[model samples]
Target: MITEQIAKDIWELHSRLFDHRPILQGHIRAFVKEFEEKRGTREEDRLNKIKTQLNDMTDKYIPETETALDTFLTNIQAKVKVAVEVCKKIEEKENNIEVGFLDLQRQRRREEWDVFMQEQFEKSAKVDQDMDIEMKKVSAEYEELEKKIEHISTATP
Candidate 1:
């Protein structure tokens, strides 16, 4: 008789547990939903904080980066300008050197021509002097021969 009562109590407990399963499941689902919502909220808050920090960093550094880049570009431009000026100076010097060389060459050629003309003038003067001396000698010899012919004619008469 006692065993029979224990078996009846056990069967009633099993029936109650089965009847409450749907309610327990509903509560578990509600708890899970609440937990998921809280987690999502925390994650959103963390992400928003990261976004704000990133925005602050960009705001703080963007102008500095732009200023540095501008400074670098200005320096490069200045250097380029200086380089161009230096190149022009170098070109001017080179041109001056070339012109000076040409001038020197022209002066040397002029000097050479002057020396050659002086030499030719001296040679022509020497030739003219020699021709004049030969002509004078020939004229004196012709006069002596004419006098001899006249004397011979007079002696014959």
Candidate 2:
């Protein structure tokens, strides 16, 4: 799952050697050109290491996230399935709602289960949304990193 800490870490790491923020007027492509034109060979190894880490961010960490999110989403789906099954057992046809038929015991149970499912759904949705946002940020950073690496690669000669 894409925890808040991981998201923050991802942004922090990307910010170390490059700027990954919104651009208002200046062009990133032009900035890369200027960077390449001005870059010196004083610390080539450090630059290479940074490049490698960037690559790993896309290759290793991103895929690992996919697996983690897949598992997380699967678990959430299971919870939803259980909720649906339990909801089906409820005989109530309350319009625009999912509650059990009005027997004292069943009604109380219905309210509890409905509330539980609503909370689960909301929580799942939030996590999914956050994961998607992080994934987008990672993708944009990876692409920008690739551009920088290519510039460095060609400009070195």
> Per-residue alpha-carbon lDDT of model 2 for 14-132, expressed as tens digits?
87657745552257778877788667563686799999999999999999999999989999999999999878666344532533334666878989999999999999999999999
* Structure candidate 1, residue pairs in collision: none
For residues 65-119, write the lDDT of model 1, one tens digit per residue.
8998998999999999999999999999999999999999999999999999999
Q: What lDDT does the true structure give each of the candidates?
A: 0.94, 0.84
Stretches > 4 Å off in candidate 2: 1-102
Question: Judged by TM-score, which candidate is best?
Answer: 1
TM-score, cand. 2: 0.34
> TM-scores, in order shown?
0.41, 0.34
